[model samples]
Target chain A: MVTETDIEKLALLARVALSEQEKEKLRTDVEAILEYVSDIRKVSGGEERAVPSLVNVMREDGTPHEGGVHTETLLSLAPKREGQYVRVKKIL
Target chain B: MSINLSELTIATARRHLANGDFTAVELAQSYLAEIEKKNKNLNAYREVFDDVLEQAKGADKKLPNFRTSKLPNLCGIPIALKDVIMLAGKRAGACSKILEGYVSPYDATAVSKLKVAGAIFLGRTNMDEFAMGSSTENYAYGVTKNPFDESRVAGGSSGGSAAAVAGNMSLAALGSDTGGSVRQPASLCGVVGLKPTYGSVSRFGLMAMSSSLDVIGPFTKTVEDAELLFDAIKGKDPMDSTSVEVSSSKLQVKSLRIGIPTMIRETEGIDPDVRKNFEDCLKQFRDAGHTVKEIELPTMHYALPVYYVIMPAEVSTNLARFDGVKYGLHVSGKNLLEDYVQTRGTGFGMEARRRILLGTYVLSSGYYDAYYAQAVRVRAKIEQELRDVFAGVDCIATPTSPTPAFKIGEKADDPLQMYLADIFTVVANIAGIPAISIPSGTAMREGKQLPLGLQLMAAHGREDVLFEAGKEFEKLRDNRGGV
Candidate 1:
């Protein structure tokens, strides 16, 4: 029941480009998987948001480690870094 | 004198190091030599730590004081990481093209614990790219072939960790399981794997695949070795809010009640030899004075469907961090949106992209109620059912995987068939309970004897129940006199 437009929109939302061939193949594969997992729709409602084990785990905002301990190391992992910051394509 | 890895467990390794029978450097070298001999074809390791011998030398310095002083269980033991678990200053790519050469800035909590216990890092093993697929075929580098038969896949996404242990490249290893990533690979590779209770082990440095289901586990030659590694790495951490203080209850009783879900008989594509092996193993327990009975879990059939909905939703969210700018592969385009689109498109493998798109669709505005929300409610229902079942039985049992190691390219083309491989093991992850896979017996496939695994699941925080049952099963299996 899913349309090609749905597939293209999903790809856009997910921010993944697809070749025409890849789009066709992915559309087919996702259709089959969706059909299989659609069985989840069969079971009715329990309390919504009633995840039995989930608890709100909040902690005070504080420095768990000394500042600057990993600043350099983390920046160093950037695919494209200029001095202290990660470089990205210009939007404007 | 040669090192007999088959005879060495963590317990014996500690004794040998304390007595100076062989230095830690020597043990590390033996494993490195084995990796060098086998890795070319098996592709078990993505990268072996260059400083392994140096780490072993540090362990050697601590050996002299160990005779009189109490030493940690994992000291001087060489272990492998499943690449998804970060080791500070080493490359961990999760076998994905996107993060291929990205180095970890800090150690995973589990890795830090192993370091404190003085375990030597042998290497980072290969895995499914972003831990997406059941077969190692999704790896960007290459597939990790089964150590038993090179033509077959070493089950994944922790395939390399399992293969390294089974192939004798390391004594013990760590892998993260979100479904059957640890136990399924262990089943295929003929080793022991343990998936501890969700939140019992911190996921601080293990890359997120499915946040609700992800747990760090151990792959080892024996169940005892698995327990040794589990003990060292399991604890609450300040960095991870979801991490829990693991207090394994002392299992006081010997005669245990084990439940075999009757729905397994209806599991599609289950090999006959696997079924026979499972029945035979159940008979062993029955003969040994433990009660084995069939239990009906009506909701069991829904586990896989639920997993697909939840896992992809989490995957799309977690991997959103890997755009062009931050970590690894960057593809330039006219502007920002195109940059992200092209980078992710080229960076991810086919399976990753499929899951990502599927996840996006399910969580999309119109479809959210039908797929994602309903799946969460059903997940809670499934957990409640399991909790009720655990009231009567100490553990639930099943074949770790429905079949023996499949051919390398056998199920690669069809993603759904590949997901079926995880049918038996995913329930444990779904319920956030502890599960273990132990080598049961071998099945003949194409005239080769491929090993199978028997899985045991216990209630949450009851890994002790699994370990006790696992050890007993191992003893019974060894004493079967080759029936």
Candidate 2:
């Protein structure tokens, strides 16, 4: 079962904030979800044998440039942005 | 002049449009009327463009002068697009309420190419929310019904595109295939569907489902139409890094070696009628002077688990953009975090939520190496297996779906059962190869005629072979006078 601590960590890792109520609810929801995936854990060594396609597909070595969706488009959707970068809530 | 342009093939419509037999406006109206008449029964369209007539007027004026002898293939053709593909100023919601009322400001690269080629856009078709389901029943707008029988599903998440073509609401439509989304529906609806090789078509403005597997192709009544549309839309697009330059070739039969994977035939839960139809397809090919062989690609057995794990992990990452703060549906909360939690919780439907949660869980730090990493490794193995098999065979054939279209809601609750719908189709996606589904025959279940699809897969950049094989099959079917 997911605990309050687990919810807090997950939310933090995902870069989203959560409240006490959400934490409580997600604890239960996430716990039930984990129960659903428990079958995967039970399958004999399925975790060790899996693989994905697109192996070693490396990006071309060139000047790092952001392509598609200009800064105007990106800034258009941001809650706030300093000249060019997204402005997030102050943590300090 | 009163002809339904949607009912005209890409070639026929061009002929009529050039001869001044009918104006584009009249052609557009005929299709609008047909859509009006059939949409309530088929659910093939989500939103019909209000300015289609205006666009058609513009197209009529822009018809190029190549001496008027023969016109461009797609000129004045009304084509429907799956809801996932963006058409500027049109809503491309992918059948989800979360994106309701969202209009694309820019057209997708393929849509833009089609527009340049003088193809008339009918409107956006319906699809499973986020292109997630096999049956279009998961669509938020409503389920798309089979044109043959309203009680059955049209197959999904390209159901609307397939249904529009099959029901004669449109002659050809663009649909994206991720796992069997495009092919399954085309088979069920008894139309031709093509999924080109990965990087064959640009994915520049499509909403992401599983990025690696998604490819935009066409659903049409004929192989010629599929080729015409695919040729026009496919090429290198700078916007998509994966886009490749593919040279179109004609199907040649010096000596074609066709592989029928016995492993898929022996897969659990294959319906008897589908098996018989698949066997008949093998026999037909043999009789047609092509060499047919049974090949073993045992790695195909693990496609589902690998796909499920890898796709959700990708889903977890891709769906992070829909947190309600930036441009989608938002539910107010006291703070930013509360707002995000509530918005995602309520805006996403049951299936979406399940996938997101599962994806999130699998991609979590500690579990990433175990689930996500391992799945990627296995994916490479599967790709190699495909390469090994293709070394001996010109193409592989299988039943598109183990069974024909089932009733809506039959497999909705069973995710595993719903997943099996893609068993025959996913290996192509996993291997990043080109595949097509052509209607082989029809099966009778409970006094109803249901369509069955035969799948043909070719090596990367080998689409001509598929079209050649499909052409012979199409000719044979035509001579049989339609099942």
Q: Number of the top candidate by DockQ?
A: 1
How do the residues B222-270 of candidate 1 rate in per-residue lDDT, one tens digit apiece?
A: 8888888898999999878989998867799989999999888887789
Model 2 per-residue lDDT tens digits across residues A1-92: 66788666665545454557756766675565455434333333334554433354456788655675555754555444577675544434
Give the CAPRI class of candidate 2: incorrect
Model 2, stretches more than 4 Å misplaced? A1-92, B1-7, B64-73
Q: Candidate 2: DockQ?
A: 0.18
Question: Per-prediction TM-score, please?
Answer: 0.98, 0.87
Q: lDDT, candidate 2, residue B238? A: 77
lDDT of 2 by residue, B1-483 (tens): 567543577777777877888877788788888899999888899878888898888888876552263544466778999989989767777787677557676789999999878889998898888888888886357889998888889998899999999988887899998888989999999998999999899999989988887899999887878888888899988788878889767666665789988796568899999999888887777876778988988667767777777777677678788766555566666767666767666666656665665577678888886666666766777777789988989899999998998998888766667887898998888888999999999999878889999999999999998888787777766676754
Give the Å error, residue B345, model 1. Answer: 0.7
Fnat measured on candidate 2: 0.09
